[model samples]
Target: MEEETRLSRLKILKDIAELLNKGTDTRAVLSEVLKNLLNVTGLQTGWIFLVDQTGGYQLAAHENLPPALTLNQCAPMCSGECWCLDRYLDGRLDKATNIIECKRLEDAVDFHWGETYGLTHHATVPLKAAEENFGLLNIGSPNKTHFNKEELALLESVALQIGTAIKRINLTQREQDLALTAERNRLARDLHDSVNQLLFSLSLTARGGKERSEDPEVKETFSYIQDMAQEALNEMRALIWQLRPRGLENGLVSALKSYGEMLGLKMDIKVKGVINLPGSVEEAIWRIGQEALGNCKKHSSQEAVTMYFTAKEQEVIMDINDEGCGFFYDEEKELPSLGLRSMKDRTEALKGHFSLKSEPGKGTKIRISIPV
Candidate 1:
């Protein structure tokens, strides 16, 4: 009988390993694993939290949660602090172990939030790969309060698999991002060396022809061509800058100020914290800033803009403001016309916040907040 139990556990581990290795989408992988884990192990309930460096967490996956815990569409699971998260933030939860009765479940029981279904306690484990700690895995059963050595071992092993899978996914994503960046650099160089140069030459040639022409109509035509070519050249340059940001290494604020000036705007820049940021954060900021300033130049009709930058341990914020001819639109309407959608997409890619407030004659302000 003992030999049969060991073989079954081994099979479960093998099956889980296969599941973890099968997918690129983090949430999808975790959801499937959590469901199967509970079914095979006889545990009735489980969940996983994917936490960021800022100590913010997302409930990545859950299984067989009782109605009380699942009340209001899992609002109980989504909000507020609990013992596991507190220990995780404080660095005390280092391994698989039984924790005190779950505070969340306790609250639900005391407040009559829902049926507890006999659940009172849970086992918690830190999900980590080497020195990089990701988050926590929690599992429990009806009327189960204490976890035995065998239970702890299973939790530990499963947590190890989950953490390693997360690390591998992150590395794979990094490699793909690096490859995409390299390709962008090559494309930017090619455009700058060929089409960009041609546009510059065309603009200059038109200007020269305008000067040398005797006919007013011919000069006017030359002037129109010159203007079109110069506008196209400026647009191309902006695209190149997006493809390969040149000045972000100095710092985000400095690069932004330089970019704003390049757009022919007087830059009033104010920064509140020591400027330090990762490359990914900086890239997202630069791209979003570029779009905001471009919108100002094209629609705001204002020559001066203000940029406010603030950095903190958990979050960084940027505000772009222009006291120009702002316009109003229906909030429900799609806003792709002014590059707002593109900017929003870039900010959200970093799990950031994007908000815009504008009214006719009231100016425009775009605020972006991103976690570090």
Candidate 2:
């Protein structure tokens, strides 16, 4: 009987490994994993959560959840705070643990979502591959209040496999992204070298013609040609900037100023305090600044903008202001634009504050503050 039991567990693990190896999609693999786990272990229900660096968790997979948790398309599982996620984000959960009572289930009951189907507890296992922690795996049976030591150990082992699988998938995706980035860089370089250079040369030639022409009509034609060529040149440069940003190596301020100029706008930038920041933080700010300036150019109809940046020992604050046409904005109202929503989401993902102010004919202002 003992040999047969061990064999059964081995087969279960083998089946799981195959599933993990078969799929590249994280959520799909997780769903299948949970299903296979329930079948092999006689668990009534299970869920897997994958957490990102920003402390956001996604319910990647789940099986046999009760009506309460599944209501409203898994709204209960997706939103709000939970004990396991909080503990994991706080770095307090490092191994398999028996959460005697799930906070989510309790909340569901308290809020009267629906029945929990007697699932009051689960085994929470921290998924890790080597030293890198990924997320959590939870397994439970109906009326089960605790997990045995052996059960916890087995779950931990399986969690490790899951973690390793996730790492593999993530690395693969990163490799593909890098390849796409390289292709974009190549295209950007080609456009700058060939098309952009031709446009610049055309503008210079047109200016020379305007200076030499004696007839007013000829001079005006040459002037128009020069302006058009210059405008096209600027547009081409903007495309290149979108493809691959240059000068980020120098500093954020320099990059933003350059980008604004590429969009045919002048930048009035002021900086105070030493500007030292992490790579990730600087990258996020750069993206946000780009979008803000782009919106200013497109909608604000401004030729010049002002930027103020302050970097302290513990935090950084940036403000962008433009004196141009502005539309009404309400904080309570649903975000009316994708650009605004994206900026807010990205800022909040870093645990930062994002605020925007705009009124008809009063210009627009954006402010962001982030802690290190």
Candidate 3:
């Protein structure tokens, strides 16, 4: 029991720390806390009540509360309401712990709120950091007298950790967004002013030189330069497209098609797909494909590769199969090269599924799927 309790605290602290590092918004932070709370307590129902702008707590995560409480149909806490919070706010209940007895609960606050709502026994703990009361954490049970003093004390500790962690997550999310935005802008401008302009000029030069060059060698040289310039421009444009914080609104089809066409010269690649996923999802897959194809050209001894993209209502899938000599998948036999790691990171960063299948003498196949 002691070990379980300690691990729970550590896990909550670690997750909250991660959340703070991620820089998610307030609601998202709270949702994560609620999820952890559910895991720690193993309660049948629960809810998080956050202090709204109205100076009273509003229901944020009411797992099994009635539609009224769960959806927050009722606004700020009111005096004499039967809700458990009424007792807490009235100072008739203990603030040091969160668990409350169902039978002992008293308030004109609408006892029916619990009786009809299917919550018999539950605990209401104040989510406080230092001395400031930020919110209420409610854990419910269908059976009477389910929560005890000891459980409430543990919950109090959990609440303290949650409050601080949520604040950190919000701060981190803001900082991360600001940093990403700044980096994206810097990269976008660099490509536009330098690489983009050069490619445009070269394309025009190659076309213009065609009429002026009477020498066959000179014409071929200009043609090759033009081709190289066009390819470079396409890639630069793709990078620019990715640099857009808004992401690829054109969806996976457009992203893959553009990427494949841009890469056709260096590698024999075929891409086919039709999708309209969120910009983030599309960008993730596009980047993964880019990294995978780059690997094919750099390391894979294959003549050609084909990428099949498909999306249904719930999932978006991609298959990159190459006829090149494949490597061993076992860690003991082979370590993940930098290129493979990059591919995995791209998928994981988007919270998607990434898998690789390969063996000596056989070809390699990369399969990835993300929720749409």
Candidate 4:
């Protein structure tokens, strides 16, 4: 009987761990915990309390408890208010071999949670892990001898397992945040190097050409110089368009059409999946299209190209196929163009994968898949 009880508790703990791994929302996890706790203890009314960073407890979950008892969003009682609360605060709950309870309100707190619900007995266990405190798991009943020693012990073990799961979630969130920050920083640097430098050069040329136009002999030369500078300025604008964040107003399809017009090439764009996306995703996809089309124009012997952009529930996919003669991926190994490298980098920077498929006789195809 003892071992069976232990195994049952272990099964509950395992479910909590599985919930943590599924990436469910915190509130959902709390709700699951509350439901499971009620099932395990056969309690009609209870509340799961948590200690905030300020050492005040808040209701995290409740089962059939009055809205007033569970919905009181204020900080919980201080550690000095109850022995159970004090034990949790002192980190003794995790180290304990048995469940502990504060049978008297004066021992846990001089509060009226039980009186309001006509309940007198309850159990409290610490919810904690190595790095931080999660809060407390407390279950209550109106019956005088409702909680047994074995039950308390089971609850305590469950609390430790909950703490570990919570800790894992917190760690995962921190890592994701760090990765996002690093990606933003990398994009900032790339924008500075690629687009900003071209604009600066265009600015200097425009100013110098305007000054030279003031002299008659230099006027003719300035016109020629001005024309060349204007061309550079136009190319710079195109580069900026490629690098800047895109929107649904100019999504993959529209952007491709615009690029076709700019290049004076007859092309068609087909779009599938969700057309609207965040700017970072749009920017990365646009850069990939730019590089692929640019390569088609520079290398392909064919005149027309077709671009397809597809979005699935979890990924964004792109296919750029040109009719021009294609070069082998292995042949390009020794000499990689800057444009292709830039496209690959942009896709990868978004946690996406990029690949190119081509043969000597077949047209080149660029493929990209980014997570949604």
Candidate 5:
């Protein structure tokens, strides 16, 4: 029986490693790992917490959680106040720890008339690769209060695998981000050097014609041409800025305001809560906002737009609305609009939500919510 159990554990580990090696998205990968842990190991509950840059733990994945330990309650348990995280922070939780009774669970049991709870103790292993500590992998059971040495060893090995996979995913994402930034810079330079210069020359030529013309009608025509050329020049510059946004380094709000000014659109902007966000989340919002503004410029009869931005601890929300001429939104016809589709795709790729509301006579409103 001992040898059979060991072989079974090894097979479970192999299956989990295979799933992790598939290069799936982080959420999907972690969810699959948690599910496999529960299914293969017969653990009553399992969860993985990831340490964010702010030194806070976020529940990245979970499975088979009981009603008493709800998701919302997980925040406090992951805080530095908890025993596992406290040990992790102090460099004491490097190895799997067995029979660590949970104070929170004890309190819950005591509060509920001193009855025995379904869970009493859990094993925690530090999810680490090299010198980097990712977070913790925790497993618990109702009947099994303590883990044997062999069980602890297997859990530690699984934790190591998870940590290594997380590191690989992060490195891959960084590489892709660098590639994207480089490509955008190249496109921005080309547009500015070629299209931008040509538009400027057209504007100058129109102005010169307007100055030299004596006929009222001829001068008016030249003035109209000059205005159009100048407008096109402004739009081109805005497009280049969108491609490579230097102002984004300053902040998202400033960059967006600058873009709106370039488009000659009057914007009513309101921001609420703290605005600090992960770089990728901020970039997604910026790109989606740019698309929405571009659509407003192209379709709206009104020149004014309203933008509201909110940043909270767990998520960021943006709403862009315009009182412009709207179109009939149909899933069959209007869904194919490149701008709308692009915005939706970008939002969904980040595991965010995108919603659009518009009618033929009514104005357009776009709302995006992203969890960070």
Candidate 6:
């Protein structure tokens, strides 16, 4: 039986490595790792907590968790001083440690919180490579009284593999971020040097022609051309600013307010709760805001727009409303407008929700809610 168990562990480890090798996204990789760990090890529940650069623990992935340990209940333990985290931080939890008792679980059991399936103990393995500590991998089973040395060893091996894969994914993401920033800078420079200069020159030439012409109609035409060129120049600058927004370094709200001012739109902004979010989440919100504002400028005649941004414990909400001319369409029969479709796709890609409302005379409102 021992030999069979050892062979089975080896096969499970091989399968896990294969799955991890094919994963590209960190979240997806961690989720698959948890799933595989539960399936192969016969554990009832599994979870991974990742330590961010700020020394905060974030729940990266989880599977088969009992109701008593729902995400909301587990959230406080993630950031608070927990046994596993304290040990990991102090470099004591370097190997798989079988925790015979967990305070959180014990409290839940004592309080008669939702079902825990008699899970009283769990094993935690630090996910580390070299000197870098990534996080902790935790697995628990109701039937198992204690994990053996061999099982602990298998857990350690799996944790090492997960740590390596996470490191690789982080490096790849950094490379991609650098590449994206470089491209944005290049595009910003090109637009300023070429199109911006051309528009400025056109405005100057149109003004000069208006001043030189004696005919009233000719002067009026030249004046209109100059105004159009100037407006185009302003729009171009706004676009360039968006391509390489310096204010985004400060925060999303500041960047968006600046953009709205540049577009000559009066913005009524309301914010609630703290706005700390992941980089990708912020980018998605910015892009969606940009698209919604663009549609407003093109379709709506209203000069003022209102936006409400709210950040809750687990999600962020953004609502943009403009009192402009709206159009009617059958939701079931026809597809959404191009801009709306793009917004929907972006929201859904992040596992969020997007909704739009409009009428013939009434204005348009777009609401997006995304989990952080």
Give the best candidate by lDDT: 1
Tens digits of per-residue lDDT for model 1, 123-150: 9999999999998999999999999998
Cα lDDT of candidate 4 equals 0.67
Reference-based TM-score of each model: 0.92, 0.83, 0.48, 0.48, 0.67, 0.67
Cα-based lDDT for every prediction:
0.90, 0.89, 0.66, 0.67, 0.83, 0.85
Q: After superposition, how far is residue 89 of candidate 2 from its true place, in Å?
A: 5.7
Q: Give the 10-residue window scoring lowest on summed lDDT in candidate 2.
A: 275-284
For each candidate, how many residue pairs have backbone atoms clashing (under 3 Å)?
Answer: 0, 0, 8, 6, 0, 0
lDDT of 5 by residue, 274-304 (tens): 8678888888889888888888887888889
CA displacement after TM-score superposition, residue 136 of candidate 1 (Å): 0.9
- Model 4 off-target regions past 4 Å? 1-7, 52-57, 70-83, 90-115, 144-146, 214-372
Q: Write the per-residue lDDT of candidate 6 for residues 198-304, one digit (tens) a residue.
A: 99999999999999999999999999999999999998997898788768888888777777767778888999999689888898999888888778777898878
Full ranking by TM-score: 1, 2, 5, 6, 4, 3
Between prediction 1 and prediction 2, which has the larger lDDT?
1
Residue 106's lDDT within candidate 6 is 77
lDDT tens digits, residue span 107-126, model 3:
21254333334444567777
Pairwise TM-score winner, candidates 1 and 6: 1
Q: 11, model 3: CA deviation in Å? A: 24
Question: Could you give candidate 4's per-residue lDDT for residues 1-372 as a string of tens digits?
Answer: 978877877887787666656754555676687687778667766556667554566566667754334324423332236666667777665643323344434322355443334554567677777667888777776554355677777777777777777777777777886687567656756766776676567667756876857777676666666676666656655554554423326556777777755665678778786645665787677667777776776688776888887888767898888867787678447326788888888887776887887888888878888876
lDDT of 2 by residue, 159-205 (tens): 98899999999899978878887998999999999999999999999
Error of 4 at 332 (Å): 66
Among these predictions, the greatest TM-score belongs to 1
Looking at model 3, which ten-residue stretch has the lowest summed lDDT? 70-79
